[model samples]
Target: MIKPIVKDQQLLAKKAVPATKTDRPIAADLIDTLNAHQTECVGMAANMIGSNKKIIIARLGPLNVVMFNPQITAKSNPYQTEEGCLSLIGKRPTKRYQKITVKFFNQAWQPQTLFLTDFAAEIVQHELDHCNGIII
Candidate 1:
C-alpha cells in the first residue's frame, strides 16, 4: 500500500511522459500504491501516485478504471459545480462538465476509449489535471 503525500508535500512539479515499456517494478509499485489509496467516491491521478505522467484511476460506484496519458479526446463543454481532492484539506466548489471522453491504455497496456457523464466525468477531469501539475 502506498501512502499519499498531502497537498503540502507536493514540492517539485513534473510533466507527463509517454507510456512506454514501463519497468515491472515501477508498475508494481504504482499498483500497490493505488490499491492502498482511499477515496470517498473520487478519482486519482498518476502524479498523486508518484509520477507526473498523464494517467489516472477513477472510482465511481463499482467501476475502477485506469487511464494512461488520458486526454479529453472529446468534451461537451464546461458546466459549473463543486470539486475537491484528497490532497486538498477539505472539499470545495468548482466547475466541471456534464460529459466527456478520453483515450488511454488498459492494464495490459492496450489502447482504450472511455465515455463518462455527470459526476464521473467531472472526477476523471479533476484527476487528469493533477497529472498535469494542476491543483484545482
Candidate 2:
C-alpha cells in the first residue's frame, strides 16, 4: 500500500510511538511510499505516511534499509547543511553529523547496529528527527 505523503505540519510534528511487531505492515507501506517518491526523496518516516510509528526507511546506495525504533548511539564531526523533505515545502538549514552509529530492529525483529557516514548518516538523521517530531 503506497500511502500518501503527510503534509500537515501538526500531524508531522507529533512524536511517533515505538513500533511493535504488529506495526510490521507499516514498513511495507512505507517502502512503497518511498519508492513512489524516489525521484525527490531518499528516505521516509512512518509519520510521513500518517502513521506515528518510530519506523524509517532509507535508500542506501542500491538498497533500501528499514529501521524500527532507530536511535543514534554515537555521532561525530558535526556539520551544517540544508535539507528538503517530501512532507514539507522548500529546504531548511540544520545540523548533521558526518558519522553516526544507530541501533535499530530490522524487519525480522532482530536487533541491528549500523555505522553510517556522510549521506547515509544524514538521511538516517533526518528520518530520526521526524520520529522525534523535530521538523527541519
Candidate 3:
C-alpha cells in the first residue's frame, strides 16, 4: 500500500542518487499525490517516495526528464521567492535560486544535464529538497 507522503517519513539523502525504473504503479501513485494536493507539477523518484534507488518522475510536459538517481551539479545563489510545497499546503514566500543545473543518469545509465528556470526551476528545487530531507 502507498503510504501517506508525510515527506519526513523518508529522508532525502545527501549523497548523489541512483535511478530506479519507475514502474507504472509508482508513477500512478505520484500522479495521485500530485493531484491530491492540487499540485500543478511534481518531480519524484522511487527513492524519494521511500525506495532507496535512483528513479525520477515529473509532471511537466515535453520535459519528460525521468532520471535515475539525479543530482544537482550546479546552482545559482539563493534570491528567495514565494514557494509552496505539497507537504505544506499553505505556504509563505521565500527566496530560492534564480537558476539551477542538474546532472543525472537516464534510465539508460547515460549521463544527462538539465537546465531550469522560473517555475520549473522552483519545482526542481522543491523536489530536490525532498531528496535531502528538506521542505520549503
Candidate 4:
C-alpha cells in the first residue's frame, strides 16, 4: 500500500525504532511507496510513511535496495549537495560522505553489508537521516 507521507515536522522529528521481524510489512510498504513515486523520489524511509521503524527503500542505479536498521559503519570525504525530502519543503544544502560502508538487514531479515560511493552513497545517507529523525 502507498501510505500517506508524514509531513508534520513534529512527527518526522521523532526517532525511528529498530525494525524487527514483524516490521517486514513496513519495509514492503516503503518499497511500494517508492515505486509509486519513483519518478519523483529515489528513496523513502519508514518514518516518511508514518511508521517509526528503521526501514528504507532506495534505487541506486540498476539496484533497488530495501534495508532495515541501516547504519553507516564507515564514512569519509565529506561533500555538500542540495537535497529535498518528501517530508520537507524546498531543497537545502546538506553535507554527505562521498563514500560509506553500511550494515543492515535485507527484506528477508538476513544481515548484509554494502560499500557505497557517489550518488548511491548519497541516497543511502539521505534515507538514513530520516531513520535518525533528521530532515536534512
Candidate 5:
C-alpha cells in the first residue's frame, strides 16, 4: 500500500523505533510507496508513512533497496548539498558523507551490510535521518 506521507513536523521529529520480524510488511510498503513516487523521490522511510519503524526504501539507480533497522556503522568524507524530503517543506542545505557502511536487514529479515558511496550514500543518509527524527 502507498500510505499517505506524514507532513506534520512534530510527528516527523519523533525518532523511529527498530523494526522486528512483524514489521516486515512495512518494508514492502515502503518499496511500494517508493515505486509509486519513483519520479518524485529517491527514498522513503517508514516514519514518512506514519509508521515509526527503522525502515527505508532508496532507489539506487534502477534498484530499490529496502532495508530494516538500518544503521550507519561507518562514514567518511563529509560534503554539503541541498536535499528535500517527502515529509518536509522545502529543500535545505545538508551535510552528508561521501562514503558510508550501513548495517541493516533485508526484506527477508536477514542481516546485510552495504558499502555505499556518492549519491547512493547520500540517499541512504537522508532516509536514515528520517529514522533518527531529523529532516533536511
Candidate 6:
C-alpha cells in the first residue's frame, strides 16, 4: 500500500524500533510510497510513513532497496550539504558522509552488509538519521 507522507515533526522525531519479519508489510508500504514520490524524493524512512520501525527505502539507480534495521557501522569523508525531505518544509544544512558501511537485513530477512559512497551513501545516512530520530 502507498501510505500518506507523515509530516508531523513529533511523529517523525521519534526513534524507530528494530523491524522484524512481521513488519514485512511495512517495508512493502515504504517501497510503494517511495515509488509514488520518486519525482521529488530519493529515499524515505518508515517514520515518514507513520510506522516507527527501522525500515527505509532508497532509490539506487533503477532499483529501490529496502533496508531493515540499517546501521551505519562506519563512515568517512564528511562534508556539509543541504537536503530536502518529503516530510519537511524545506532543505536543511546537515553533515553527511561520502562513504559509509552499513549492516542490515534485506527483504528476505537475511543479514547483509554494503559499502556505499557518494549520493547513495548520503541518502542512506539521511534515512538512518530518521531512524535515529534526527530531524535533519
Give me the candidate number with maximum lDDT. 2
Give the distance in Å from residue 89's predicted Cα in candidate 3 to where it truly belongs.
3.0
Estimate, for each residue in 2-73, the C-alpha lDDT of model 1 and write its tens digit: 746435545314556656547223445455565666444356766665665666777765767776667888
lDDT of 3 by residue, 1-136 (tens): 4436545543544432544544434555555555554444466645445654545556555445555556777778677676655445777676678678877765565788888766677776666666555555
- Mind giving the per-residue lDDT tens digits that candidate 4 earns over 1-136? 9898889988888889988998888876887888888888999898899898889988988777999899999999998899998788899999999999999999899999999999999999999999898988
Alpha-carbon lDDT of model 6? 0.93
Which ten-residue region of model 4 has the weakest summed lDDT?
27-36
TM-scores for all candidates: the values are 0.80, 0.99, 0.66, 0.97, 0.97, 0.98
Q: What is the C-alpha RMSD of each candidate to the true structure, in Å?
A: 2.6, 0.5, 3.9, 0.8, 0.8, 0.6
- Quote the positional error of residue 80 for candidate 1 in Å: 1.4
- For model 4, state the Cα shift of residue 43 in Å: 0.5
**Candidates ranked by lDDT, best first?**
2, 6, 5, 4, 1, 3
Best by the TM-score measure: 2
lDDT of each: 0.68, 0.96, 0.59, 0.90, 0.90, 0.93
**Clash count, candidate 6:** 0
Give the better candidate number (1 or 4) by lDDT.
4
Residue 42 lDDT (model 4):
95
- How do the residues 1-136 of candidate 6 rate in per-residue lDDT, one tens digit apiece? 9999999999988999989999998888998888888899999999999999999999888989999999999999999999999899999999999999999999999999999999999999999999999998
In candidate 5, which residue ranges exceed 4 Å CA deviation?
A: none
